[model samples]
Target: MLHTNARPSDRHRPRGARGFGLAESLVALSLLALLLASGLRGGTALRDRWATAGARDALVALVHEARSRAVERGGAVVVLDASTHVARLESGGDSVRQLRLASEFGVQLDLGARDEVRLVFDAAGVGRMASRSLHLTRGASSARLVVSTYGRVR
Candidate 1:
């Protein structure tokens, strides 16, 4: 069978012997490098996301504890120490509960203007502070925890 549409170069070597050209090889290597770089970036982002989420959960639990204690002890204070990553609940000038966020989540806090944040809850379990914003960071990721005046967390 004579092929009329075949290329002039097709008359040379046997079939099934073709290999990747230089351009194909370079493109493959480039794609592999891109995938590796993205994977590393994704891993760092995942780590930071997990840490920030853990910190947020800890904050909500601490806030709830403070509110509950205030209902029982007249009033309670939740003092967050950014430097040490410790949160303390105080009632009647005595510590009721204390937790270290960094010990578990390895997160850092950024509270504007001060290294501490104090949110007070009254006997009715209502928050005494205005809407407060706290920033939690771990490595390259960050998250916000907004505490409403009614002690609601988001």
Candidate 2:
């Protein structure tokens, strides 16, 4: 058997530096909690932005579809009604599509001077109305879909 000069109490002692004190541990925990909270807030803002973008894209696509359909079918394609939260498309008195916006997105439509805007596209892909701007808004952010008299969307 090997002989050792160390005392019995020395065996129970830590080999090197001691672990963190109570105050140090508390400070670390508080920092971690603050970091987590900020991350959560960022995530929520990102989600809201995504939803707003999605809603705007969908609206633009609907307009394009109606325009194309009017040219192909050789008749009028109409966006029958558009309000703060909904838009309806119709071709030849038949429902083409309907889009309902979510409340969380807070989307609003601003078709100037019109309670409900009827967007009419003729067979030649020309709009009956003059050049106008259709505004889509979510909170402070907004997107504009401009409709020219020549039936161009930008």
Candidate 3:
């Protein structure tokens, strides 16, 4: 009374048994897409922040450079901005250098109520403008870069 043939379950299993169900596949795909989208958005935000910060630091450096140059060369140095975003330094009608910041950085210098901004530093490293506030803005946030008289550059 021994049975020679095996039962149907023992003979074979479905080849696609290891594969995920349709619902499971759909959910996994959706999660992956969401993750990818968020990562891309975060990267974009980070890039914008980095560009804005770099531009701000460059502006600060330009101010310090102009002051230092005036003291070192024993002459008057000028930090002027012909446009809102572009800034340069000059000494005795000669352009000392052009800053690396351009309009693409999203940095705007708002003079507030002033007609123009022409910061001049004397040979003794003293600011001639007395007291002034230069606005540095990126997107919705802004900060003031103030310079006081007595050759002080802040």
Judging by lDDT against the true structure, name the best candidate. 1
Candidate 1 accuracy as lDDT:
0.88
Q: After superposition, how far is residue 112 of candidate 2 from its true place, in Å?
A: 3.1
lDDT of 2: 0.73
For each candidate, what TM-score against the reference? 0.69, 0.68, 0.67
The residue-by-residue lDDT of candidate 1 on 1-154, one tens digit each, is 7658757887686887688999999999999999999899889889889989888888899999889989998999999898988888899899988877778788888887789888999999999898889898888888899999888888
Task: After the best TM-score superposition of candidate 3, give how far the Cα of residue 23 lies from its true spot, in angstroms.
Answer: 6.5
Model 3 residue runs over 4 Å out of place are 1-29, 36-49, 100-104
Encode model 3's per-residue lDDT on 28-137: one tens digit a residue: 99999999999987777676667667766776787788888888877555454535466778877788876644465766667777646778888887877767777666
**Residue 153 lDDT (model 2):** 74
Taking the tens digit of each residue's C-alpha lDDT, what string does model 2 give over 18-37? 68999999999999999999
Clashes of each: 0, 0, 2
Residue 71 shift from truth in candidate 1, angstroms: 0.8
Report the alpha-carbon TM-score of model 2 versus the true structure: 0.68
